[model samples]
Target chain A: MNWHLIAAQLLNGLALGSILALVALGLTITFGLLGLVNFAHGVFFMVGAYAGFVTFQYTHSFGLAVLMGALVVLVVGIVVERVVIRLFYRRPPEDQILVTFGLAIVIVEIVRAIFGGKTQLFPMPSWGMGATNLGFLVYPNYRLQVIVIAAITLAAIYLVLYKTRLGLIVRAGIDDSLIVNILGIDVTKTLLAVFVLGAMVAGFSGVIDAPIVAVDPDMGASVLIESFVVVVIGGLGSFSGSILGGIIAGEIISITTIWAPDYAQVMLYLAMALVLILRPQGLFGTEGRL
Target chain B: MMLRAIGDRSTWRVELAVAVFLIAFPWVFPIIGGYANLATRILILGLFGIGMDLIFGYTGMLSFGQAAFYGTGGFVTAYLLSTGMLHNTLGALAAGTIAAACCGMIIGYLCLRQSGVYFAMLTLAFGEVFYFLENSPLAKWTGGENGLPGLPKPVIPLGFTTLHVQSNLALYYFVAILFFVGYWVARRIVRSPMGAVLRAILENPARAAAVGHNVPKYKLAVFTIAAAYAGIAGGLLGIFQGYMPPDAFSIDQSGEIIIMTIIGGAGTLIGPLVGAGLWSYLREALQNLHGVGAFWKLILGLLFIVLVTLFRRGITGGITDSIGLFRVRRRTAAAHVEEAPAVSGEVQP
Candidate 1:
């Protein structure tokens, strides 16, 4: 391939990578701290995207739309935790997974009933609408914005997880929730906050991704699976690993598309399967969990 | 001694009555429900649900990839039979089931290592991958998004006469027979030692492992068995409907099986069949009701959530428990009567 095409593919890879990072971050925290799979996280993402779409129609302001979307999703997440998920925390992981799976179906079906099954469109805001032409290649302006936003968000999350007390508790919970409780800290509030934060992160991803992909009730289904690959590749709960995994998956999809466009998605699963064979806990994950 | 003998005989009688009802379901349903096509569809879906129940209910593995094998087996059989390569329908269907089992082995090998949600996600990836393959690259073989149409009905050579298993009534008979056979086989599997081990794994993998059971092997075996059952059921769908739609590979297909199993009662052999019958019947009935176009799925979702919240044991399990309660009450009453004479003798002394 020519350098221009390669460069374009690289940029596309970055766009996909950014989305993966955002989604994986949502999964990483919930899985890392709460030890719950949260199969409905994808539904949360869809809800956020749909909320953003609605908000944008009303206010015509992207920032306002994102804030509204994130807030709505945050509330939904907390409500789910209080009603269904809290009961699952003490049960088997499979029960939590199935319950969330059922809840996801409910959420998606509700959205479909309300919005109809057709794909809904959201225009990229004026600031992120145009293309940027490099000397070697041209790239979508919105995609470039996604990269910048993702970097900032990733850094922000890193700070929240590493520097802040909440982050410390989450990290502690990740290592061992029992130990965190033994330390006489209020782990309950920490869990509730982390659940909300995870939902917000997913919400952010949804808002950002709405313009690039068609916003539909079933939109989150595929993205949810891809995010799983990222989490597995990057190592669950490892911040840097998520970034690395996201990039690797993005490149895998983009580069494979060059060879066989149809096999791009299949190849990603094959890659995940291979990874599972080689490292069951994932690339950067600690051993023994699996 | 007489009471114990009577109890055993009554249990056998109930089982025999249930078996007779299932055997006559196809012949009798049309008279009651006014739609035999719907009943056949329910049976096909029920068979698929039984396979899923084995994996999720017994083995404790929640897979989202059952549809992958279903689609693969279906398309393969359809292509072969339609292309004139495989003349014998039974042979072609058997090959399809075996092929799906092979696919299951490959997927299970990679996925079984990762337990819980990760395994579920991985299966989802595999399912999507298979869907993509069927949609684009292998469209020539799979017939792409439209799916393979013109699937022929199976014919059996009875030596004395050839029986053409065609039309709704005939296909209904064919599918009903297979459903019964599949149900019988699955029941046997559930009652076998392997089934007990699978239940053990579901209860506690660590304990199962510590107890010297090859947990992974059992998991893989059960997964393959489930895939085989899914494959056969899928093949029957193509033969029954005369068309294999791409929707078979959709996430909805996998989700439908999960919902059917949960709604019917997991861990019980007949739960999925009952669940499938209820779900399919409800959907058809609701759809036919005016002003319920796409809202039917939404209504079902609400129903599912309510069921999960209230009837975690599902319909079949709930009924079984109620029946069990009644039986226990009768037995306790008999025990009270038996004790009365002994108490009177003690009072006299």
Candidate 2:
């Protein structure tokens, strides 16, 4: 067995997993709080990449690009929540899915109209251009940075969700919104905050992932579906589950790519199906929460 | 009494009306600037949406993975015909439909364990699995990205005389006949006692189960039937275009069918057909207009959002609702007039 190759792939999987965890975290929280299956989440990811790309074109600073990616999507999320998602709270789950799916199409087409449908390259940030040599394998510095950034972001989210008063309300609401409402906490504000936070995370990951993957109008479709797998594997509304599910999905894809590249995605889906069949509520997910 | 008779299930007025519409669509559509090929495509999508309506509209299972069966049925039939394994077109279509139905049964069994959003996500993931399988692993048989091309036009053997569907009109008629049968079957299912159970499940699964109906069994059955509809439609698409495009298995295909079903009106059997016609016609028309080609989807998306938000019942639903309301108002007015005369007679006595 080539231990060195395995080690390299493992690290690559971690990097991929971190990004997926970040994306899934956003989806999980909104679903937990709002019970909305936001199909437009993927479009937000694409919008972030484009936002960052445009920012980088002008500022030429990856930091500013990242900030702009998050900020633009943050505003976009706010508008979408206020104008559209707010109305859907009383609607059925299928209605929410359909509206958001429509929103995704609209947003993607708008992007396509502004920037042609062709794939665009997001250059590696100047600071993240080189390779870092570990004992076993040399890896891209940007990917390592992504891991660090995602970890910090995840940690920050953890603090907000667990350590703060608002976090308590959010968590409680996830368990039972009606009970939380009866407790005199403002559930509406908390819901808005969580939704926007999820959107920002999606945007942030999209910009960070820009250098790694091709940037295109339709890029978010696959990411959205993958994150759905992650959310399912982690159990809907479970933070730790998202992280674990993301890593597992990442490892399954990367490791499978080593032998059968074509089966990487298939393996990820199979793993999800198995998780669903074996433990429908997910490994960390509490049953009946959703 | 006459109105009740007209509305009775024994009367085939609705069926007759639909038949007239189908027969006249080819000619009427051209008047509205739609061509033969677009009409055929509408029928195919409409047939696919009928199955979706059965599951979603009546059964209340909003699946996002129907393309799995669609592409499965299309590819299987296309592969069989293209490889010369199936000499009869109808046989290949049947084979494809059955293959898709089996897939649906398996997928439905697994997915039915969950309901609502979880179910949607699971189906979407599974749909992607089929898509990836087609794009990579099964590419040898499926023709990968290029898709299976050079499929022969549909030829139906009637035992005594064979029907060669060669002309565009002939192909349209061939697909139309199948669609009519599919529509008729779907109507039967919706009106049947079993359909009432499906509706009960849709309205309230807990209550449906409380009433001794097996909810899961009903869901799976309807889901399988829906898959059969998608399968036959997929097979027809392969024959219609004479080439099975890989996009048949795409998420877009699945999403678009749902959009069509919803936009036309769910729970209404003809709703999908109306939605398909509108969607296909608008798509073609918008794409042809100057400077509007690229933004057509964007416009449609905006329109879909508006409809979902404001007109939840969709075009056909809204029309039927208004018509019903008008009839009710007229009937009440007539009743009030008769009551006044009776009151005057009593006062005279």
> Each candidate's TM vs. the true structure?
0.93, 0.95
Cα error, residue B103 of model 2, in Å, equals 0.4
* Worst 10 contiguous positions by lDDT, candidate 2 chain A: A183-192
Where does model 1 exceed 4 Å of error? B1-18, B27-34, B328-349
B1-349 per-residue lDDT for model 1 (tens digits): 0112113225445345546765677677766564778878888888888789889877779898899889878887888788878877887889889998999998888888887777888888788888898999999888898898887778777779878876777777788777778876776686668977887777667778998999999999999999998998888888777788888899889888988898887766577877888888778777878888567777777777777666766777666655554565444523322231122113221
TM-score of candidate 1 to 2 decimals = 0.93
Top candidate, metric lDDT = 2
Error of 2 at A143 (Å): 1.1
Candidate 1: residue A19 Cα off by (Å): 0.7
